[model samples]
Target: MIRRIFPYPVLSVGFFATWLLFNQSVTPGQLILATFFGVTSPWLLVRLDAPPFRMRRPLMILRVLWTFAKDIAQSNLRVAKTIIASPHPPPSGFVRIVLEMRSPYGLAALACIVTGAPGTAWISYDPVDNVVVLHILDLMAEDDWAASIKTRYEKPLMEIFE
Candidate 1:
Protein backbone atom coordinates (compact mmCIF):
# COMPACT_ATOMS: atom_id res chain seq x y z
CA MET A 1 0.00 0.00 0.00
CA ILE A 2 2.75 2.40 0.94
CA ARG A 3 4.77 1.51 -2.16
CA ARG A 4 1.79 2.08 -4.41
CA ILE A 5 1.00 5.39 -2.76
CA PHE A 6 4.63 6.58 -2.88
CA PRO A 7 6.29 5.00 -5.88
CA TYR A 8 8.92 7.71 -5.87
CA PRO A 9 8.66 9.59 -2.64
CA VAL A 10 11.87 11.55 -3.11
CA LEU A 11 10.79 12.70 -6.59
CA SER A 12 7.38 13.50 -5.17
CA VAL A 13 8.88 15.70 -2.46
CA GLY A 14 11.09 17.46 -5.00
CA PHE A 15 8.13 18.08 -7.29
CA PHE A 16 6.08 19.41 -4.36
CA ALA A 17 8.86 21.78 -3.41
CA THR A 18 9.25 22.91 -7.01
CA TRP A 19 5.55 23.52 -7.26
CA LEU A 20 5.54 25.60 -4.09
CA LEU A 21 8.54 27.54 -5.31
CA PHE A 22 6.96 28.20 -8.69
CA ASN A 23 3.67 29.35 -7.21
CA GLN A 24 5.40 31.27 -4.42
CA SER A 25 2.51 30.51 -2.19
CA VAL A 26 1.53 28.30 0.74
CA THR A 27 -2.22 28.93 0.68
CA PRO A 28 -4.56 26.00 1.17
CA GLY A 29 -5.48 25.83 -2.54
CA GLN A 30 -1.83 25.97 -3.63
CA LEU A 31 -0.87 23.40 -1.03
CA ILE A 32 -3.54 21.06 -2.28
CA LEU A 33 -2.43 21.52 -5.88
CA ALA A 34 1.16 20.97 -4.96
CA THR A 35 0.29 17.84 -3.02
CA PHE A 36 -1.77 16.57 -5.91
CA PHE A 37 1.08 17.12 -8.39
CA GLY A 38 3.61 15.58 -6.03
CA VAL A 39 1.61 12.38 -5.73
CA THR A 40 0.25 12.18 -9.25
CA SER A 41 3.30 13.14 -11.27
CA PRO A 42 5.22 10.00 -10.43
CA TRP A 43 2.11 7.93 -10.90
CA LEU A 44 1.61 9.42 -14.36
CA LEU A 45 5.21 8.75 -15.30
CA VAL A 46 4.87 5.14 -14.20
CA ARG A 47 1.75 4.85 -16.27
CA LEU A 48 3.68 6.24 -19.22
CA ASP A 49 5.97 3.16 -19.11
CA ALA A 50 8.92 4.72 -17.37
CA PRO A 51 11.66 2.29 -16.64
CA PRO A 52 12.20 1.21 -13.02
CA PHE A 53 15.32 2.90 -11.70
CA ARG A 54 17.70 0.60 -9.87
CA MET A 55 21.15 1.09 -8.48
CA ARG A 56 23.14 -2.10 -8.08
CA ARG A 57 25.83 -0.65 -5.85
CA PRO A 58 24.70 2.45 -3.98
CA LEU A 59 28.10 2.70 -2.28
CA MET A 60 29.86 3.32 -5.58
CA ILE A 61 27.81 6.51 -5.97
CA LEU A 62 30.11 8.42 -3.60
CA ARG A 63 33.21 7.60 -5.61
CA VAL A 64 31.49 8.39 -8.94
CA LEU A 65 30.13 11.68 -7.59
CA TRP A 66 33.56 12.70 -6.29
CA THR A 67 35.14 11.95 -9.66
CA PHE A 68 32.38 13.83 -11.45
CA ALA A 69 32.90 16.93 -9.31
CA LYS A 70 36.68 16.82 -9.80
CA ASP A 71 36.29 16.35 -13.53
CA ILE A 72 33.93 19.34 -13.79
CA ALA A 73 36.41 21.60 -12.01
CA GLN A 74 39.34 20.43 -14.10
CA SER A 75 37.42 20.67 -17.36
CA ASN A 76 36.33 24.21 -16.53
CA LEU A 77 39.89 25.28 -15.93
CA ARG A 78 41.09 23.65 -19.15
CA VAL A 79 38.33 25.25 -21.18
CA ALA A 80 38.91 28.67 -19.64
CA LYS A 81 42.66 28.54 -20.33
CA THR A 82 42.11 27.41 -23.88
CA ILE A 83 39.72 30.25 -24.54
CA ILE A 84 41.66 33.00 -22.74
CA ALA A 85 45.32 32.12 -23.22
CA SER A 86 45.61 30.11 -26.39
CA PRO A 87 47.49 32.02 -29.12
CA HIS A 88 45.44 30.30 -31.80
CA PRO A 89 41.90 29.04 -31.53
CA PRO A 90 41.67 25.56 -30.05
CA PRO A 91 40.93 22.74 -32.45
CA SER A 92 37.37 21.46 -32.54
CA GLY A 93 36.01 18.14 -33.80
CA PHE A 94 33.36 15.52 -33.31
CA VAL A 95 34.50 12.20 -31.91
CA ARG A 96 32.29 9.16 -32.09
CA ILE A 97 32.43 7.17 -28.89
CA VAL A 98 31.05 3.67 -28.73
CA LEU A 99 28.99 3.42 -25.56
CA GLU A 100 29.09 0.26 -23.48
CA MET A 101 26.15 1.11 -21.24
CA ARG A 102 22.97 -0.47 -22.66
CA SER A 103 20.51 0.66 -20.04
CA PRO A 104 18.57 3.80 -20.97
CA TYR A 105 19.07 5.26 -17.50
CA GLY A 106 22.80 4.64 -17.60
CA LEU A 107 23.11 6.13 -21.08
CA ALA A 108 21.12 9.19 -20.02
CA ALA A 109 23.35 9.71 -17.00
CA LEU A 110 26.48 9.43 -19.16
CA ALA A 111 25.07 11.92 -21.65
CA CYS A 112 24.30 14.37 -18.83
CA ILE A 113 27.77 14.02 -17.34
CA VAL A 114 29.52 14.55 -20.66
CA THR A 115 27.30 17.43 -21.77
CA GLY A 116 27.27 19.10 -18.35
CA ALA A 117 31.03 19.43 -18.27
CA PRO A 118 32.71 22.36 -19.99
CA GLY A 119 34.17 22.10 -23.52
CA THR A 120 32.21 18.99 -24.43
CA ALA A 121 28.82 18.71 -26.06
CA TRP A 122 26.73 15.64 -26.76
CA ILE A 123 25.67 16.03 -30.37
CA SER A 124 23.87 12.83 -31.24
CA TYR A 125 23.59 9.25 -30.14
CA ASP A 126 23.00 6.25 -32.41
CA PRO A 127 21.11 3.63 -30.48
CA VAL A 128 21.55 1.00 -33.15
CA ASP A 129 25.32 1.23 -33.06
CA ASN A 130 25.56 2.34 -29.44
CA VAL A 131 27.70 5.24 -30.57
CA VAL A 132 27.62 8.82 -29.29
CA VAL A 133 29.00 11.71 -31.30
CA LEU A 134 30.50 14.33 -28.98
CA HIS A 135 31.79 17.71 -30.03
CA ILE A 136 34.92 18.91 -28.23
CA LEU A 137 36.10 22.50 -28.16
CA ASP A 138 39.75 21.50 -27.84
CA LEU A 139 40.35 18.40 -29.80
CA MET A 140 43.43 16.49 -28.82
CA ALA A 141 43.34 12.77 -29.66
CA GLU A 142 40.30 10.64 -30.36
CA ASP A 143 41.83 7.55 -28.76
CA ASP A 144 42.66 9.45 -25.61
CA TRP A 145 39.12 10.82 -25.28
CA ALA A 146 37.63 7.40 -25.92
CA ALA A 147 39.85 5.82 -23.29
CA SER A 148 39.12 8.56 -20.77
CA ILE A 149 35.35 8.31 -21.24
CA LYS A 150 35.42 4.52 -21.11
CA THR A 151 37.58 4.18 -18.03
CA ARG A 152 36.65 7.29 -16.11
CA TYR A 153 32.86 7.34 -16.52
CA GLU A 154 31.41 4.37 -18.36
CA LYS A 155 33.08 1.65 -16.30
CA PRO A 156 31.81 3.02 -13.02
CA LEU A 157 28.37 3.64 -14.49
CA MET A 158 28.26 0.08 -15.75
CA GLU A 159 29.04 -1.16 -12.25
CA ILE A 160 26.25 0.96 -10.86
CA PHE A 161 23.59 0.21 -13.45
CA GLU A 162 24.45 -3.14 -14.96
Candidate 2:
Protein backbone atom coordinates (compact mmCIF):
# COMPACT_ATOMS: atom_id res chain seq x y z
CA MET A 1 0.00 0.00 0.00
CA ILE A 2 1.11 3.59 -0.61
CA ARG A 3 0.72 4.46 3.05
CA ARG A 4 3.08 1.72 4.23
CA ILE A 5 5.61 1.98 1.41
CA PHE A 6 5.85 5.76 1.28
CA PRO A 7 4.35 7.38 4.32
CA TYR A 8 6.35 10.48 3.38
CA PRO A 9 6.29 10.66 -0.39
CA VAL A 10 7.96 14.04 -0.52
CA LEU A 11 10.81 12.90 1.69
CA SER A 12 11.31 9.69 -0.31
CA VAL A 13 11.46 11.47 -3.66
CA GLY A 14 13.81 14.12 -2.24
CA PHE A 15 16.16 11.50 -0.83
CA PHE A 16 16.17 9.55 -4.08
CA ALA A 17 16.84 12.66 -6.13
CA THR A 18 19.60 13.80 -3.75
CA TRP A 19 21.23 10.40 -3.89
CA LEU A 20 21.23 10.42 -7.69
CA LEU A 21 22.63 13.94 -7.73
CA PHE A 22 25.37 13.02 -5.25
CA ASN A 23 26.38 9.96 -7.25
CA GLN A 24 26.35 11.97 -10.50
CA SER A 25 25.69 8.88 -12.56
CA VAL A 26 22.88 6.36 -13.06
CA THR A 27 24.85 3.20 -12.65
CA PRO A 28 23.16 0.00 -11.48
CA GLY A 29 24.98 0.17 -8.15
CA GLN A 30 23.84 3.76 -7.58
CA LEU A 31 20.27 2.91 -8.46
CA ILE A 32 20.26 -0.04 -6.07
CA LEU A 33 21.74 2.05 -3.24
CA ALA A 34 19.29 4.88 -3.78
CA THR A 35 16.37 2.49 -3.88
CA PHE A 36 17.54 0.87 -0.68
CA PHE A 37 17.75 4.18 1.15
CA GLY A 38 14.44 5.47 -0.14
CA VAL A 39 12.64 2.29 0.85
CA THR A 40 14.29 1.94 4.26
CA SER A 41 13.68 5.52 5.34
CA PRO A 42 9.92 5.23 4.88
CA TRP A 43 9.86 1.90 6.66
CA LEU A 44 11.72 3.34 9.64
CA LEU A 45 9.41 6.32 9.76
CA VAL A 46 6.34 4.15 9.70
CA ARG A 47 7.56 2.37 12.81
CA LEU A 48 7.71 5.63 14.73
CA ASP A 49 3.86 5.94 14.64
CA ALA A 50 3.77 9.69 14.39
CA PRO A 51 0.40 11.33 14.06
CA PRO A 52 -0.48 12.88 10.73
CA PHE A 53 -0.03 16.61 11.18
CA ARG A 54 -2.80 18.78 9.86
CA MET A 55 -1.12 22.08 8.98
CA ARG A 56 -3.83 24.68 9.30
CA ARG A 57 -3.28 28.09 7.72
CA PRO A 58 -0.25 26.92 5.72
CA LEU A 59 0.63 30.49 4.68
CA MET A 60 1.62 31.10 8.28
CA ILE A 61 4.64 28.90 7.65
CA LEU A 62 5.89 31.44 5.15
CA ARG A 63 5.32 34.19 7.70
CA VAL A 64 7.32 32.23 10.27
CA LEU A 65 10.18 31.73 7.81
CA TRP A 66 10.29 35.40 6.91
CA THR A 67 10.21 36.43 10.57
CA PHE A 68 12.98 34.01 11.43
CA ALA A 69 15.17 35.28 8.59
CA LYS A 70 14.73 38.89 9.65
CA ASP A 71 15.44 38.07 13.30
CA ILE A 72 18.56 36.13 12.37
CA ALA A 73 19.94 39.01 10.36
CA GLN A 74 19.22 41.61 13.04
CA SER A 75 20.46 39.39 15.86
CA ASN A 76 23.69 38.67 14.00
CA LEU A 77 24.40 42.39 13.80
CA ARG A 78 23.54 42.96 17.47
CA VAL A 79 25.74 40.10 18.61
CA ALA A 80 28.61 41.34 16.43
CA LYS A 81 28.34 44.80 17.99
CA THR A 82 28.37 43.36 21.50
CA ILE A 83 31.45 41.30 20.73
CA ILE A 84 33.40 44.21 19.17
CA ALA A 85 32.54 46.91 21.69
CA SER A 86 33.61 45.08 24.89
CA PRO A 87 32.74 48.29 26.74
CA HIS A 88 30.38 46.66 29.24
CA PRO A 89 30.05 43.12 30.53
CA PRO A 90 27.49 41.12 28.56
CA PRO A 91 24.10 40.92 30.25
CA SER A 92 23.47 37.19 30.00
CA GLY A 93 20.81 35.35 31.94
CA PHE A 94 18.22 32.61 31.67
CA VAL A 95 14.51 33.15 31.35
CA ARG A 96 11.72 30.61 31.48
CA ILE A 97 8.92 30.78 28.93
CA VAL A 98 5.62 29.04 29.52
CA LEU A 99 4.60 27.40 26.28
CA GLU A 100 1.00 26.74 25.33
CA MET A 101 1.84 24.34 22.53
CA ARG A 102 1.66 20.75 23.66
CA SER A 103 2.40 19.08 20.36
CA PRO A 104 5.92 17.63 20.18
CA TYR A 105 6.51 18.88 16.65
CA GLY A 106 5.44 22.40 17.56
CA LEU A 107 7.65 22.42 20.63
CA ALA A 108 10.64 21.22 18.61
CA ALA A 109 10.11 23.96 16.07
CA LEU A 110 9.89 26.55 18.86
CA ALA A 111 13.15 25.31 20.36
CA CYS A 112 14.86 25.46 16.95
CA ILE A 113 13.61 28.97 16.35
CA VAL A 114 14.75 30.24 19.75
CA THR A 115 18.17 28.61 19.52
CA GLY A 116 18.69 29.70 15.92
CA ALA A 117 18.43 33.33 16.99
CA PRO A 118 21.99 34.58 17.70
CA GLY A 119 21.32 36.14 21.12
CA THR A 120 19.36 33.21 22.58
CA ALA A 121 20.08 29.56 23.30
CA TRP A 122 17.50 26.99 24.40
CA ILE A 123 18.57 25.35 27.64
CA SER A 124 15.89 22.91 28.78
CA TYR A 125 12.18 22.25 28.45
CA ASP A 126 9.85 20.89 31.11
CA PRO A 127 7.01 19.07 29.42
CA VAL A 128 4.81 18.87 32.48
CA ASP A 129 4.83 22.60 33.02
CA ASN A 130 5.15 23.37 29.31
CA VAL A 131 8.03 25.71 30.15
CA VAL A 132 11.22 26.36 28.19
CA VAL A 133 14.41 27.84 29.64
CA LEU A 134 16.53 29.99 27.38
CA HIS A 135 19.80 31.84 27.94
CA ILE A 136 20.08 35.22 26.31
CA LEU A 137 23.37 36.98 25.57
CA ASP A 138 21.78 40.38 26.21
CA LEU A 139 18.99 40.33 28.71
CA MET A 140 17.78 43.92 28.90
CA ALA A 141 14.18 43.25 30.00
CA GLU A 142 12.61 39.84 30.60
CA ASP A 143 9.11 41.03 29.79
CA ASP A 144 10.19 42.54 26.48
CA TRP A 145 11.99 39.38 25.41
CA ALA A 146 9.08 37.18 26.46
CA ALA A 147 6.58 39.37 24.65
CA SER A 148 8.69 39.43 21.50
CA ILE A 149 8.98 35.64 21.42
CA LYS A 150 5.32 35.04 22.17
CA THR A 151 4.17 37.53 19.59
CA ARG A 152 6.75 36.89 16.89
CA TYR A 153 7.32 33.15 17.05
CA GLU A 154 4.87 31.34 19.27
CA LYS A 155 1.73 32.97 17.96
CA PRO A 156 2.54 32.14 14.35
CA LEU A 157 3.49 28.59 15.25
CA MET A 158 0.28 28.14 17.19
CA GLU A 159 -1.67 29.22 14.16
CA ILE A 160 0.18 26.84 11.85
CA PHE A 161 0.75 23.72 13.98
CA GLU A 162 -1.80 23.83 16.78
* Strongest candidate by lDDT: 1
lDDT of 1 by residue, 21-86 (tens): 999999999999999999999887777785777899888878878988999999999999998899
Regions of model 2 farther than 4 Å from truth: 20-28
Q: Which ten residues in a row are the worst by lDDT in model 1?
A: 44-53
Each prediction's TM-score against the native?
0.86, 0.85
Compute the lDDT for candidate 1: 0.91
Q: In angstroms, how far off is 117's CA in candidate 1?
A: 0.7
lDDT of each: 0.91, 0.88
Off by over 4 Å in 1: 1-7
